[model samples]
Target: MANYVFGVDIGGTTVKIGLFTTQGEMVEKWEITTRTDEGGKYILSDIAASVEDKLAEKRIEKSDVAGVGMGVPGPVKADGTVIKCVNLGWGIFNVEEELSKLLALPVKAGNDANMAALGEMWQGGGKGHKDIVMVTLGTGVGGGIILDGKMLAGTNGAGGEIGHICVNDDETEVCGCGNKGCLEQYTSATGIVRMAKIILNTTDKPSKLRQIQYISAKEIFDAAKEGDELAATLVENHGKVLGKALAQIACVVDPEIFVIGGGVSRAGDILIDTTAKYFAQYAFHACRQTKFALATLGNDAGMYGGACSILNQ
Candidate 1:
């Protein structure tokens, strides 16, 4: 086996890279700005140059490296073909081949969310479990499903696109994905604020939320924890939608546990308890025993997961 591995998580604004031992111990991590100009033609080359520089600075030989693993912010086929990553201005192309040729080493790639799930399963919240679902509740809801320690990439590389699942048919507003009433519409960080605004406008609940010029998910959760009835109710409603959706997902994947991550998940016990309570109510009886935990890897999860991908292969 090779001595070290590199993990790369490609984002719209930056690319996070981590150097790790083959045994999964992260040695160092860093980031570089994402140059998305010219249809992202320079992104991969830039990453390759960065990795090369790191190798030289560390005095690590290319032969001693196992391979590089990458997480891209879009659907990626098992063969490393990125369907499209609009965030990076990338079109359909085989990413692994390009990067591998650039570095003259083996490489692997997967969806960013899926990589996060792998990272959790490897050393974070989903540790010791082979079946797991990771939910990231940020500006948008993102998810990744892993079963028996394998990612379900699906035929179109959209297997774990849980956020796009239609949850409400009556929604009149469109989501970023051009869908209405998606699970993301009610469960993401933005979704929390959006719902709070609706409640404050439609009803005179006299919420602390009304005082903030710019309400955020953090403030809402803080108010709920501090005994604000309106905030608590909003949190309950948000949890209800999220729990119900997770229950439906459980019926399909039957994962061992759900790992919650992202900015909104910082609400901690309030988020987990409320969601778990409703999950038990809606989950299939056999699946009600599934567990929920917060992701421990945080922003570094994608990096760990990217490395884990190559190591696993």
Candidate 2:
């Protein structure tokens, strides 16, 4: 009988693999280096070998496994085709079919961000809520939307590209997506540092942030926590933009909760508190009271989400 499932989260540097019961309890997890060489020719074969070794080590029969669910770092078609993943040196291809053929098992795939949100909804911050939007703030911002317990992987797989939402039409600098004034340009970790530099250069504000040679989003939050005036301003500005964008998202999805994750979310309550404050200020009346929470699963979220996908399927 099919009693187990495998969850794989593919990243630029590593691939995180997890073994789980059909009930969603993780049994074991491990990682392998991602070989991006030769246009990622070895990635699928490597994963197949690793999965075989793991099943053998666990004495689990191939027939006893339900399937493998993978999370890729790029847009994925509904049929599990990856359009492209520059970081992984990949081009358009059917990841599901290739990996399935290699392993001789069923496979399912989705965008990593969407998988993270699914994980959160299944077992993390958004567990109790069926409708939620997850925003991941790292070097850049990533997002995913879940409605009525299903992921909305829209046409072209760009449903939850919230980071690219144009927030500042006046911005002179273009975003990584080649857009000017994207939400990521102001709310990401790098965006915070960029804003801090502009604040330091444009204004002679007597603040502790001016002392740091290399400023990071964490540093800014730390200084803000200590009551640094300029740092507080920067944090507030970050909150304003982020909260406003979230409010806009709420207008569309009307999710019950907003789960915040990624590296920048390390600021904890301060980030949520400030963003909530601004969200209330700008949100539509009916959605103004929407809840916000921090993602508790961290990096393992993708693994859990991958497993959830197969179980749900």
- Predicted structure with the largest TM-score when compared to the true one: 1
Clashing pairs in 1: none
Off by over 4 Å in 2: none
List model 2 lDDT by residue over 90-209, tens digit each. Answer: 999999999999999999899999999989999899998989999999999999898887778887877788999999889999899998999999999999999999989999889998
Q: What lDDT score belongs to each candidate, Candidate 1 first?
A: 0.95, 0.93
TM-score: model 2 vs. ground truth:
0.98
TM-score per candidate, chains pooled: 0.99, 0.98
Check candidate 2 and list the clashing pairs.
none
Return the number of clashes found in candidate 1. 0
lDDT of 1 by residue, 195-306 (tens): 9999999998887889999999999999999999999999999999999999999999999999999999899999999999999999999999999999999999999999
Lowest-sum lDDT 10-residue window in model 1: 150-159
